[model samples]
Target: MLIRSFDVLPAIDILDGRAVRLSGGKREAPTLDGGDPLRLAGRYAAEGARRLHLVDLDGAFSGVPRPELVRDVAAAAGIPVQVGGGYRTLEAIEAALAAGAQRVMVGTAALSATFVRRAVERFGDALVVAVDVRDGRVAVDGWTHTSELGPGELARRCAELGVVRLLVTSAARDGSLAGPDLPLLREVLPAGLPVLAAGGIASLADLRAVRDAGCEGAIVGSALLAGRFTLAEALATATG
Candidate 1:
């Protein structure tokens, strides 16, 4: 397979200000404790992660963000941070960017075409839309509510709205570490946009598979925290 400029974004999902990884995106699901968020971010950066994917689980569920936490982590990581959770409005997106995020991901609010248009017009490349999938439909509200729109349709809309990139996740595979849903990634790839795959990324081979599937990047959480592979090994696999 031809190698590409694929990035490996080490993920830190914060719940109650501590690092944790949820199975299948469920808050109640079994979590792998990752200790302190700030420490993890710093460690990932030190280990050669090009970017950090930070999500506030509390903010995702409550529709309120903790910008202070984002600020602290972003500052400490010393690398570009992409933040998500509860960024459903222009104000919220702005706050996240102002708080030190290089990019802010919009999930539930991405359902509104008007909101997406406005956000794209305002933020441009700094905006990323999350197409979190469950049962072949888009899952919103922290993966609790399944929308009628399918991933392809939503992906096309995002592309049309001038969205610079997408973060695609399979709700079932998320944290399951079975493997990446390559068919789903293929389905969304036809939209003619760059996609970052998340969920079920368990090993160096999975990283290679995701890169071979033409993903721009992979957002890895559970496997990395579980010691399935180190970030250094993942980066080497992705670049090869």
Candidate 2:
């Protein structure tokens, strides 16, 4: 098998303008505080992060995005950023891109084929559909609602709609550090679409597993924040 080049995107999840990680995608769950979003972005960039995964946790729950914060982090990180949360419309998506995001991830909106087709037509490769899974079903509305669509079904839909990539997140494993849901990756990878795995990435070994599962990249959160490993170590493991 040909080993594909993999990317390790350090995640900076923002809540109320501060960096935080919500356990298991729960809005009210206890958060792991990661001080000063811009500072963290800069630090990650300095530590050799190729790209940053920025999430507006506040916007995700409230349906109000903070594009200015995205702008600030992107400017501070001085690297490519893929931002998500509350981007349900073309205008909202445009705001994030205008703010400095190289790519914008849409969740609930992606459930609509019309929206997916239009988003792909408008943004092309800049649009990424977030296929957040919970109990084998696609979760949406900031992961508060579970849909009937499965991960594989959603992946196939996005691929058919011309979505450039899918960000597959295991809501149950997110921030738990139990380990990645490789089985979930396997379910979606068969769609023959580019995928970026998120949630429960605990160690370098977990990163390797994600790579071996054929993910285009991995979005790591809690582990990196808890000092489980350095960003340099993650990048090295992903590249090798």
Candidate 3:
């Protein structure tokens, strides 16, 4: 995609290594996880998606990484898997890598700069830091952990800690299929870095909007997974 020089990273979230939808990115959504996540991952990869976003909803709720399931999806996907959700320990992070995750996203760990640096220094730039903002404040632990940290400060902290990319998702907009908050992106985004703007993306036009606002990509869940839009078509639209 000629999207202001930003790459669009398509999403493939897994609750139980199966395709499922979450309401507001919360676990309360009606489960449609009848299909295997491995198959879904392969589908996305076959569709020309370079990176895949997978979430361990069960693990997130349990405070542990489901190594077996994560490994299964990674092995099957044949592409880089950026896995996240419910990862809070060094052992968990290491296990995720050992399971073949190219990149591991940390939400709760992002709050502590030391932990982020530890993962980054050990794992390098592929280690992504997540900034899940609700009402402009950062939240973690499946959106249960609330913090007073502002987006700009958190982005700066993550950037300073050797994290190459910061993922900014609006909790309010998540899974609403409305759209991303561009004004917030423009205001809180740090210069000279890539911001993965996620949540509430419902159409190709929304992708263009995020690209126009200087976001590298978007994290689309409900819409894309439900077949409201196809990844290949979205890519064609974004790249077109």
Prediction 2 TM-score vs. true? 0.98
Candidate 1 pairs with clashing backbones: none
Each candidate structure's TM-score, on Cα atoms with residue i matched to residue i, is 0.98, 0.98, 0.91
Off by over 4 Å in 3: 1-4, 31-34
Worst ten-residue run, lDDT, model 2? 1-10
* Candidate 2 structure quality by residue, lDDT tens digits, 1-240: 244699999999988777999998998885699999999999999999989999998889987888898899999999999999888999999999999999999999999999999999999999999999999999998999999999999999988888879999999999999999999999998888889999999999999999988899999989999999999999999888
Model 3, range 37-135, lDDT digits (tens) per residue? Answer: 788888888988878888887877778878887788888888888888888877888899899888888888778877887788788866878878887
Indicate the residue-level lDDT of 99 in model 3.
Answer: 91
Q: Candidate 2, after superposition: displacement of residue 167 in Å?
A: 0.2
Please report how far candidate 1 places residue 105 from its true position, in Å.
0.2
Candidates in order: C-alpha RMSD to true structure: 1.5, 1.1, 2.3
Residue 31 local lDDT, model 1: 66
Error of 2 at 61 (Å): 0.4
Per-residue lDDT of candidate 1, residues 121-145 (tens digit): 9999999999999999999998999
In model 1, the runs with Cα more than 4 Å from the true position are 1-4
